[model samples]
Target: MNTKIAIIGAGPAGLMLSHLLAQKGIDSVILERRSQKDIEETVRAGVLEQGTIELMRSVGLEERMNQIGYKHEGINIQFNQERHRIDFPSLTNQEVMVYPQHEVIKDLLNARQKEGASIYFEVEEVELFDIESKTPSVEFTQYGERYSIHCDYIAGCDGFHGPSRKAIPSEQLKEYEHTYDHGWLGILAETAPASEELVYTHHPNGFALLSTRTPTLQRFYLQVDRTDHIDNWSDERIWEELRTRVDLGNGPELQEGRITSKNIVAMKSYVCETMHYGSLFLAGDAAHIVPPTGAKGMNLAMSDVQVLAQGLIEYYQDNREELLNSYEAIALRRVWKAQRFSAFMTKLLHPEQGASPYELRLQESELDYLVSSKAAQQSLAENYTGLPIEWEKGKKDTILS
Candidate 1:
């Protein structure tokens, strides 16, 4: 089969890229190793940045989100048993939607289906070929049927472990990585949210975040050992850690109910330089990763595709290569910004194990300053709500390089 672009993976980045390209009469096919049910059911934390929400609205995919998603204009950063609210709108004229990532996936999937877009799920042995050439392609097997797609470009959205990133020669891939000692043990409970807005807590014990998935379901996280297993954290132990770290005295106790799901997400920040090789362009987790602290993962992924879609659109419609040429530099600027914010937020909330008393005091002072200073709060609010994108649609000038 011949197409303009061959997209790897069916995650947010891949699906969104396909959708955007379709809007411009550009044809692309998506190859996903997982089934549609699998991708739709994998629950993940979602904190939609303002730009993400706008992008969804622009694409006509925000209808379901508007009908069901919760909107939060503020988040509480708690310390010393006190919760301080950072009003995003008041600080930065922005707000975030507390929609789950899976829900967004469902929306994107549905939209693509309605548009008759081709997305192949449950494909095996996906591989790329001749990515450096003008004529690139992808080969994969679906249910014992071998298929090859000849396309002009390949988008490596297959995620961190997917084959796309590894397709680049190791000698050409420069990686920067920082692995933290802490991880987040998260659970989804069938209970009402304890707080109306998200709560991020820092305590001597560790860090905990309280977020709402739905009115009837609550999501909570507690900092734990990076190597800790789900077997070590029973339902009771999970609740105890959350209460110990996040409870506010003289306030409503955290609502509790049957725990439905549990996951342990390791803390790490990683960035792959250039984010592309030849005709292969990487977006989302295939390119970089951030700890979930700043809620930048999904937003960054979507942003990467937005830039990518713009580049591809220009190449197809206007015969322009400037945007496509500068895609890496453009995506990296926002990726690194997110890395900085996510790292800072992670470090600020979690006390390092075996940190010196002086170091602990300094962290406390940092929090103290953050809470007391408007400039600091605004900066945090802006980053959390997503700083503005530098790329503009249909702008031919390449300021990125």
Candidate 2:
């Protein structure tokens, strides 16, 4: 019933936070509403930043990922049926790994289990009490029995829909959000990847992306009306649209296969300027969300928890409160930068819902400038590979609460 920290949700942010804390000799309990099998089976795209990849290795959780994850040096940006490649290593000296988020969960969960850490799954009706006080508690049900967890601190890594955020008093929190008019219809199929690197397409029809999950499993996405339903897209129609949107003479031809999963995800940019509200500190999707256009989703979540872990470590190890006090400010800086890049990519690729012909040409002109200018390409490569994060551990003399 009592722990040092009570973490809600077993997703990457929660699990990674616990793992990082454990490595620093802290104790935490994890609570999840979904079953372990469910979380592990849900397939979500992960484009790991260089920092994230190194962080996983630092905490002894890189065995499986290093063995199975795909690495890429850059990505292709296509517009007006012409393709341009941005080389990340040469431009930014970084690379990304294509490892799905479920794999990260599995790795972190397995690491916790091996260390005798406790994670309670399938919990229901979770509620937070005294989140603004030093003595916070999490209440929920499991297997038809009510239970509670009392901890010195509470982490709201439970995501946007979880009780953690809702528990925050609305008067003390400020939220900024922008929901796009279009969404991505994504699929996982058994087929060869359309290219060695990820392909981002800007077409007259809509935006499309080609990504890889495995040697033979390809993940792809297409922009569609936000109101569109999965029922409107058959496997054949989905393939046709993808082919049409991504078609360019410079890239590989479309390869169709048997799709195993399909879903529609709306594009949205959200930021909770208040990541720390008293004893409850939010991370990952609980604090911010970026559209998938920039492949920043999982990477941003990992970084959020990284900063949280460091802050907690400083507090418990040295009794310093500065890092913890400045959690919201530090996390928000990068969150907004990510939102900028994601928004730029979304707006640059997805044509306006109703735009004049001149407005449409302006989008293509920007792409033309990007492809022709090394300075612009370098900027894209830098942002795409990842912006600088505070990778070093320990506190700085400059951080102001």
The top-ranked prediction according to TM-score is: 1
TM-score of each candidate structure, all chains considered together: 0.97, 0.96
Off-target runs (Cα >4 Å) in candidate 2 are 249-252, 390-401
lDDT of 1 by residue, 1-401 (tens): 99989999899999999998898899999999999999999988899999899899888898888988889999999999988999999999999998989999999999999989988999999989998889988999999999999999999999999999888888999899999999999999999888999999989888999998888988999998899899999899888788888877786598779999998989899999858789999999999989999999999999899888988888888899998888898888888889999999999999999999899899999999999999999999989999766674333222222
TM-score result, candidate 1: 0.97
Whole-structure CA lDDT of model 1: 0.90
Scored by CA lDDT, what does every candidate get? 0.90, 0.88
Model 1 clash number:
0
Error of 2 at 388 (Å): 2.0
